[model samples]
Target: MFGLTFEKLLLIGVIAAFLIGPDKLPHYAQQLGKLVRNMRDYANGAKDRVRDEMGPEFDDVDWQKLDPRQYDPRRIIRDALTDEPEAAPAAPSPNPNSAYLQHRAKQQALATGELPPFDNEAT
Candidate 1:
């Protein structure tokens, strides 16, 4: 079940048969079967306990909606990138001390063929 196909399981069983030998393979196989059964029972018991604790609401849960497999990182990113952003609030009066205004001023100076203001302290 953990990525082991039927063919792989067969190969493993064959190897186990050779390694364990015909004398004691049956005992080990029986133990493995018991282990698998117990694990399955444990999982089912846990599920039942959760259902009991959750009451009737557990049956109404939309499990498919919560499934991790349904999420695609690429699709999520694409949707986010393609979606139009919400309109920004109306601009307030520009503050001279703001970095955005400073950058804008620099851009305007460059566009008008003037040297942008520079701070010697920043260098």
Candidate 2:
């Protein structure tokens, strides 16, 4: 359950058997099983308690939406790579005297070390 594959778990069992020895192995195994069971029971009991305290409205919550794993990089890249129609580009303004052009001019002047005439009206 903790990302352990069958081979890794078998290797761990062999090591444990060797370290613990055959005589006390069953006792230790039983204890380990009991510990796992108790942990699962405690988790389930806590979940039940939280659900009881929160009431029926909690059942309607979109749990997947709240999960942080949904924002994983793999999912984000997959979504971006899908063949969705691109969003339409914004229409260009016909007016040449737009504030953006003025801003660009100001930026060009600043790049050339010539400050654009500052308007006192801006104050």
Candidate 3:
């Protein structure tokens, strides 16, 4: 399960048989089987206990969304960076000397080849 393919397992088994010899092989193999069974039982029991405690909410959970393997830092960052900001409110400005009006006037003057207004007191 931990990246050990059939050939690798076979090689490992052959090496174990040679090192342990035929005399005590059966005893060791039986012990190994018991250990594997115990580990499996422990995992199953833990899962069952959690399910029992969680009740119906366990089934309702979106397991895939919670999975860490599905997360990509680069994709998350890219999406965040590319997302557009919400448009500002369309309410009319009450102030006559607003920066938006000043900017618009400057843009209009520039388009008509006229000098833009300069306020020395602005700085």
Candidate 4:
């Protein structure tokens, strides 16, 4: 805590206001406000940079693990695709009858020119 007392701070403020007048005091205060905001922004950017470079390990790795700032999107994608064993999808080429059965019902209707059932209110 810099050991800065309230009395000392008040005295400094009083002196600054007296020396710099009322009109210029407002302008000086505005500039000081801008400097404080810029410092805060720089600090946040630096923190993010350090987090990304350190990876998932580090003491401040709370958010980094739950929702990481992606350094490499391709790496994440690659891991997601290959990490888990996938259920082999039933392919159509090897079993020819399955494919035929899928289309047979549709083919029969088309040949008869039956146009399927219609709904009056649909239009």
Q: Clashing residue pairs, candidate 1? A: none
Ranking by TM-score: 3, 1, 2, 4
Q: Tens digit of lDDT per residue, candidate 1, span 77-111?
A: 43454444333325633553343443446453346
What is the C-alpha local distance difference test score of each model? 0.74, 0.73, 0.76, 0.69
RMSD (Å) of each candidate, 1 decimal: 12.1, 11.1, 14.3, 17.1
Q: Which TM-score value belongs to model 1?
A: 0.57
Tens-digit per-residue lDDT, 7-123, candidate 3: 999999999999999999999999999999999999999999999999989899998899999875544543454444333337744773454354455453365676778999998
TM-score of each: 0.57, 0.56, 0.59, 0.45
- Lowest lDDT sum, 10 consecutive residues, model 1, at 80-89
Tens digit of lDDT per residue, candidate 2, span 1-123?
A: 899999999999999999999999999989999999999999999999989998997798889898987675533543455445234326644663443454455453355766778888886
Candidate 4: segments with Cα more than 4 A from true spot: 60-123
Worst 10 residues of 4 by lDDT: 83-92
lDDT of 4 by residue, 4-106 (tens): 7999889999999999999899999999999999999999989888878887665655666576565545444434555453444445346535433544544
Worst 10 residues of 3 by lDDT: 80-89
Instruction: Report the number of the highest-TM-score candidate.
Output: 3
TM-score of 2: 0.56
The best candidate in terms of lDDT: 3
